[model samples]
Target: MAGENVLVAVEGRRLQLSNLDKVLYPSDGFTKGEVIDYYSRVAPVLLPHLAGRPLTMRRYPDGVDGQSFYEKNAARHAPDWVRTVTVDTPGSSTGAETLDFAVVDDLPTLVWAAQMASLELHIPQWTVGPRGGRNNPDRLVFDLDPGPPATIVECCRVALLLREKLRADGLEPVAKTSGSKGMQLYCTVTTTAPKQAWGYAKELAEQLAAEHPGLIVARMAKNLRPRKVFIDWSQNHEYKTTVAPYSLRARERPTVSTPITWAEVESCREPGDLVFTADDVLDRVDEHGDLFKPLLRKKNPPKLTALKSR
Candidate 1:
């Protein structure tokens, strides 16, 4: 199966895909072909969120039960048609000052990445400028992680509180399941410096943690997180990335980072209520038509500066 290949044409591009029968999710018996199919169907909505952003892929060459690695540098053997951007990585661990990262802006690129078993695709808040430079972040994100005794139920509570605060600041927020143990909140913003965005998120998180000391933990200490939600504001950093919406996570099953409605968050009573599989996501997309699409609006988005000094 590993050596077998299927040649297909996608949007005038020819690609050779392999190992379609290989089971990537052993528990679900989900194969590589299914993974590609999922991406294909979801591409219409998924591509906009990924366009022009540098991507960090989580690869599972041997399946979810096997070893995996993060791929920041585009594969040397990647097709010449694959677009990439070389960015500076100051104080690099591998001693390279810069890395060439893949930009998945089209359906063909998405399929090729799936063929390599890149189950999770991670991206930052900013998009690359037309001139190959980094633009200011156009969105801000809050990664709400739950500690051991805590779960999505608790994350939902914190999310509701964040919604109130964000709305008061004139910014609208949207919710999404992390496809792991927690959830995330995203808000569109006028192009703002990453440092400013990070500062706003950090201050807001600390403020909420102060108001609801028992329910939220703004700091990253493992001991402080017991039975509380850790509002990971640091994800707003320019170099940091959050899982792309609709991306499959490297979990025991093919869980997806799914966009959700506020009503669902308000009524979430158990962790199972928020968990979504790849199949579940496809169905929801057909019904909801990209609930997170509001984040893509470029007109008159609120500025993060209003809350920075609060």
Candidate 2:
């Protein structure tokens, strides 16, 4: 019993009903109470982990297949603060029914979206990003990304190693899944000239690659990294786009870009071992607060700049 209100439509006619606290999602229905329950359970773990910032959750209806559905509707609900955009959809639709909400705010919104999209529609999985929401950030993506056969553990190791090095340079590094087989390392920096940002990231990545040799490969093209992780700098460009923050991808089981703790990184050996579902992410969010908040505050978000040289 979160509350009472259901905005519905009948035969092309809209109807507003009172004392209706239940949400009738095509995949699964939830009452406002359920959403609130999840929030209370998860917020504690998620709040501290955030980069000391407010979170912006991307709702994927019916999982990744429902990405387009969400993207089309996101414009209406997304707060005015988002900036960076990336999508993790598998490029397909779930082919399921959908419902709409007028104002889905706060952590409750996340629980409702996950339950409805994942449980109700049965889409594959979901991926997520930091809650810069419109003002989030256009990350300087160093895709030290590896391909199949690369264990998640190995990828995470590379990420952690990079994290240590980046921290020494006064840059905060936050890691997330590529929503595929690799990991993405995002560093928050001041809105220096775009060239400065790109130059800083490129230099750092290239230096790391040189230090690791076989373990780290710095190449712009995918073909170059037949088996190694490529440090992609193109994402650092101002106009360049990554996946939308909460866009879903077309995976059969529906996974999300859930956060991982340094403890998990220290203990795990493969990325596959860390796959997380929509039902489980909020708990982690509660545990960690926001991992990207430190970096976001250190660096003043993204800014427009002329392209810089390598």
Q: Which one is best on TM-score?
A: 1
User: Per-residue CA lDDT of candidate 2, range 116-174, in tens?
Assistant: 33222111111123432223333455665675455566677788878887666655566
Over 1-310, each residue of candidate 1 has an lDDT whose tens digit, in order, gives 7569999999988899999999999999999999999999999999999999998899998999999988888857468999998877776677788888889999999998898899999999998876669988888899999998899999999999999999998889999999999999999997556588888899999999999999999999999999999999999988889999999998999999999999999999989999999999999999999999999898889877846565
TM-score, model 1 to reference: 0.97
lDDT of every model, 2 decimals: 0.92, 0.48
Candidate 1: lDDT over CA atoms?
0.92
The C-alpha TM-scores of every prediction are 0.97, 0.56
